[model samples]
Target: MPKFAETIFQIMKKFFLSTTVLAIIACLLWATPFTAIKIGLKYTTPLQFAGLRFFLSGLIILPFIKDFRVKVKEASKRWRFVLWVALLQTTFLYGLFYTGISYVPGALGAMLIGAQPLFAAIMAHIMLRNDKMSWQKVFAILLGLSGVCIISLGRADFVFTTTIPIGVGILLLNNIVGSTGNVIVSRDAKNMPPRVLASFSMIIGGAMLLLFSIPIEHPNWTAVHPGEYYISLGWLAMVSALAITIWFGLLGREGVKVSNLNTWKFIIPIFGACLSWLVLPNENPDTISLIGMFVIACSLLLVNFLNRRAQKAQVRLSSMASH
Candidate 1:
């Protein structure tokens, strides 16, 4: 029995590591959106973009499912977790985040919204005894923040101005909601299969966004920028919508913020500072940007390691006590 339990643990550990890697790649992939949003802003209002992105992303996801005709109406009825997920992650968070981008720079706005992970880390520690805060995790949080400071000090391109305070405020609200949603997901939605949870959330969220978009039809096709049109659309669909949907599913089960902290381990400040080049072609990411990214990555890795080691130790202690 002990051997079998250990084997299962080992398998789960490996699976988590792989999923963590994929999740990180997805996080980095999302870095491009900072630039894409700048381009997207050139054509559409923030509300318009938010509504369109959700609608388009949801549409893209629907065709890919194997059993599109099949419906599991009972899942949400059986589990109230889906309702909270729909309201927090898809409906409010993205709506505010996408809209906020209209008021702030995409890259900079993305960085500010990073408060989500900070909230995630703290919430995970408080909410889950298994994911207690450790010195190493503290170091990781500090390191990640330090990287952001480095970028702020060096980059003349990103100015923290007053016009966008409202935008930033909205994002902070989004961050709070997003983080709480993650905690709920981690506690309640862990039992559901990842794909099912993800698909359901997206469908619910997309419906909400569409319902809201009707009143704000400022959509003028002539306003669209040819160069950024398809690229921006693709980014919202693949990265922001689909990628985030999968991540929300993962987070609901694994402390989305904590599980996601791995990706932020490096990409936030690095991409935050450097991505101006990809997202904003005229802007340049200096050495300071790269250094900031490196520091943040180191911090997150340290924290993640501490958390994992602590979890392992707790398990061992439990086994000994049982024996």
Candidate 2:
């Protein structure tokens, strides 16, 4: 190989192996699934599709888990906690998510879901005594909310017949439910194995969705789907499995700060929206929507910055006290 080519290859190898790069890759995987979900929903009802996707994701993770039966038994001890997480995180959240995404543009759905970290911060503040909100967090939340409002306004036609408003509202509610589930896990599931928690929650929650769909959606299970539908479903399931597994691995790595890793998630909306515009024929970029996305991105960055600063300040104070 030429010296220049060799040097570029070495750089790329190192970049691909780094934790930061892996985190970004996980975010990218997460971003792609919105477009896939939109495609899959075309062939089946929202809940039915989401159920199969998550159930498959759970099964995919099972083989990788060491001593799966033992871990499951341990998880069963906290079955209530696990069930709550399943209901809130996977079932209710994704149930609303699929329904909401069905009605909205894929870019809008991605942007709304990407705003979850802001809601998560609020949930943490409310639920954890140590995570009380500061002025910076308050400001970040307000800015994020404004961005959400802008994005909604940009998409709305102000007509009663349009489902855009309803879709946006459901997605916003989806974020709240998701944030609540995060807080519950953070506060209570400290001792549980992460993989086990994820696996069971997805499996159980997905089953609930499937059962619920029978009565509510009345889906035609016998109907055959095109190759495109199966392709979308497979991609979505793989994305969920890989993204969650990768994220959990990153969290376990030494010296990898959760806040820093989480910062990469800010790019999810940016990438997701761009991908939707690129891949989906009906979706296109608008100036207002772009502006809204930029605002939301800035808000997430501001919040993550403030959080890291606060963590550093606390570390310094603890050092001083110890000395």
Local lDDT at 116 for model 2: 75
Q: Which ten residues in a row have the lowest lDDT in candidate 2?
A: 254-263
Among the numbered candidates, top TM-score falls to 2
lDDT of 1 by residue, 1-323 (tens): 69999999999888865656667666766766656766776777665666566666756665565554443554655446766677786888878777776677645664676555676767777777655565566666666766766765566456666868888888878877777777777777766555556666766776777667667654564553686677877776777555665565556554344534433634655654555676656777668777876777677677667657766987999999999
Candidate 2 lDDT over 43-68, as tens digits, reads 89888998999999888888988997
Q: Candidate 1 — which pairs collide?
A: 35-279, 137-303, 140-299, 185-252, 186-252, 251-256, 265-297
Model 1 scores a C-alpha lDDT of: 0.65
Full-model lDDT, candidate 2: 0.77
Model 1 lDDT-worst window of ten: 254-263
Per-model TM-score on C-alpha atoms: 0.78, 0.79
lDDT values for all models = 0.65, 0.77
